[model samples]
Each structure stands twice: as C-alpha cells, then as structure tokens.
Target: MRKLLASVFVVAMMIGCPAAHAVQPDEVMEDAAKEARARDLSRELRCMVCQNQSIDDSDAPLARDLRLLVRERIAGGDSDSQVIDFLVARYGEFVLLKPRFTLHTLLLWLLPPLALIGGGLALWFYSRRRSKAGSATDPSHLTEEEEVRLERLLAAETSDKQA
Candidate 1:
C-alpha cells in the first residue's frame, strides 16, 4: 500500500507542466535588483479574485496580470510602498489579506464573541426559569384536611396489602 501511494504521488508530481517553468527569453529578468524587488512586492500583494492566496502563488490569469504589472512598475523605478499604494488605491482596502482595524471592522471582529456571550446568558436564564418552573409546588395548595385524607388513604392501602 505504501509503495502504491508513493508511485501515485510521483506520477501526480510529474504530470502537470507549469507555464512559469517554461519562461520565454523576453520574460527573463534582465537585472537582479528588479527581480528581487518583484519577489518582495509579490509576497506583499494578495490576489484580489482569490482572496485566500498571495499574488505570487495564484495561477489565475488576473493574478498573472497583476504580477506582470508589479514587475513593470518595479522595472519603471517604483518603490515597494508605491506599488502597494497604487494597488490599494485601485482596489480599495479589500485587496489586503489582513483587514485594517477600523470602527466597521472592529464591529465585525467583535460580533461573534458578543453574540456567543449574549446567547449563553439567554440560555442560562431560560434554563434557570424552566428549572424553577419544573420544581415549583402545585398551584393549588392542599388544605390540612386534604393532607390528612391523603395520609389515611396511603395507610389504608399498606394495611390492605399486608392482609
């Protein structure tokens, strides 16, 4: 079973031919500095369409285009901050993987804990009331005469059983 699993993994690894690996002559980075800058910026940028993935790891066409744009901007002498600022301006703060702490975002972050605590309190109160209700004595209180009658009936049943 281990050998079979290993062979399957090796086969899967060898199957897909990645386009990035077969780069054209023109696509090659002419300068080491620009290449480093591109790598640095790509890591910082999140893929807008694929909200979970970094722009560097995403293989979507839009991610590829954004990567190309980052490379072009870096090659044109834009600083890392400038490239990031440009993207933020174009896509709004949603492009960032980490949402900034603001009033609206703060509420979003706090909602779950607030709801959990509120729900727990409500449940506690409800169950406590229910338990109290369950344990309550009968609404109609038995008079002393009724209580004496009940005891007599119980005693009669026991005496009859021993006969």
Candidate 2:
C-alpha cells in the first residue's frame, strides 16, 4: 500500500513539473546564442491574445507566431534591441511586457501615486468635517434654551417618581 501511494505521488510530481512551454522543438534556433536571444526577446513580448501572459508562456496561436518571429529576427542578425524596436513599431507599445518610459506613459506611472495622495487628502478633509460637525452638536455646547428644557424634563421625571 505504501509503495502504491509513493508511486502515485511520484507520477503526480512528474506530471505537475512539466509546465506547458509553448515553444515547440522546431521553433528553436540552431545557433545557441541566437536561441538564447530569441528566448529573452520572447519573454519581453506580450501575448496579444492572452493579454497578461508573455509570448513565451502563452499557448495562443498568436503567441506561437510571435515566438517564431522573434527567432526569425535573431537569425536575420538583428540585435535584441533592434528586434524589440521592430515589434514595437509593428504592434505598438502594447506588445511589450514592460513599455519604454515616455511622455505618453508618464501618466500611467504617475496616476496611482496621484490617486493615493488625492484619496488621503479627501479622507483627511472628510474626517475633519465630521469631527467639526460632531463637536458643534455636542450636549455640553447646547444653547441656553436647550439646557433649560433638559433640566425641566429631568426635574419633572424626579418629582413624578417621588409622588
């Protein structure tokens, strides 16, 4: 029984360890240096169909095509930067997993911090307003007429109890 359980565990591990790599054997370049460059480029390129995944990790047909294109560019003697630029020009900045820092992307980077500071300011002002409103209505700060009315009500209750 123990051996059967051990066998099942080993099989499960082996099956789980082979994560789906979209690169087929045929897609790999003959030159080791070019293959390495292609792989690196693949990791930087976004899988357009699977927006969140890199081309290297995506199983989408478009991702496979992108992977092949990277290898083709590498084989054609394009520098890594050149290959990236080529793809960016063809597909726009969205094809890059990490877009270049530019004027257009400045807002993308700044908006989160700006939003956080704005939210904090709003919260601070809201809390201040709430505290001021609470203090203004406090029983200790009631008008003379309100205080006299409360005292009479209390006195009437006490006299009724005594009677």
Candidate 3:
C-alpha cells in the first residue's frame, strides 16, 4: 500500500511538471509575407482594450481579431495606408496610437501650451498684485511710536536677562 501511494504521488508530480510550449499543429500560415506585414502594422496600432500596449503585444481577444484582420487585408494586397484607412473607417481615429493632426484634434494638441500660458499669466498677475499691495515691510516704514515701544521692550528684556 505504501509503495502504491508513493508511485501515485510520483506520477502526480510528473504530470504537474512544466513542459515546453509549442504552437498548435492545426494552425497554418496562408502567406508568410502578409503575416510579417501584419505584425509590423499591428506594432503601430494601439490595443483599445489595453491602452498602453500595441495590438501586436496584446493577448486580448479583440487584439487577436484585429491582428488577423490586418493579416487578411495585407494578404489581399492592400497598401499600408489603405489598411490603416480601412481600420480608421471601421473603428474611428481613436484606434490609432498616434492620431493624425487635424482641425478636430487641434485642441488636444494645443491645450498643454495654452494651459501653460494661462498659468504663467495668472502667476504674473498674482505676483504683480502682491508687490503693489506693499506686503513686504521695510525698516524705514516702522512708525515712530512702534520704534520707541520696540526699543523700550528690548531694553527691558536685556536688563531682566542681566539681572
């Protein structure tokens, strides 16, 4: 019974061991050149589901379908620009990682600089207001009564310390 249990444990451990990964035998490439072109195009296309990753690097089902569609288009002899246009037509400009510059996208491109200029103007206006309001005190600006009182207080403090 002990030997049988040990064999069973050994067999289970062997079954659980990691094995080398291999692509499935059923998958076949209709055209290797098209596959390469698709891969290159997919590298430039962002995965909408995973914004930071390109479609080529994403494992999401949508990314896989997009990759396959790109391959099919390339195999159909579509130029790079034509493939991109088709995708844009189907999925909007948001599908692109770097959207093209246009009147519609002008605000998206200009907002950062516009915000910076506005912020700089605000800071300048605020600083100008602060300076004009005389917030910084000068020694000459002290009133005669205040100077006298300060001198008397200092004298009293010094005498007390000496005592």
lDDT of each: 0.76, 0.90, 0.77
The clash tally of candidate 1 reads 0
Tell me the TM-score of each prediction against the true structure.
0.53, 0.68, 0.62
In the order shown, the candidates' Cα RMSDs to the true structure are: 6.6, 5.1, 9.3
Mind giving the per-residue lDDT tens digits that candidate 3 earns over 109-133? 8998999999999999999988777
TM-score, candidate number 2: 0.68
Model 1 agreement with the true structure over 35-148: per-residue lDDT tens digits: 778766776677887777767767667777778888888888888878888888988877766666788689877888999999999999999999788766543466789888
Model 1, residue 73: displacement in angstroms?
0.8
Tens digits of per-residue lDDT, candidate 2, 128-148, equal: 999999999899998999999
- Highest lDDT: give the candidate number: 2
Off by over 4 Å in 3: 1-40, 132-136
Question: Clashing residue pairs, candidate 3?
Answer: none
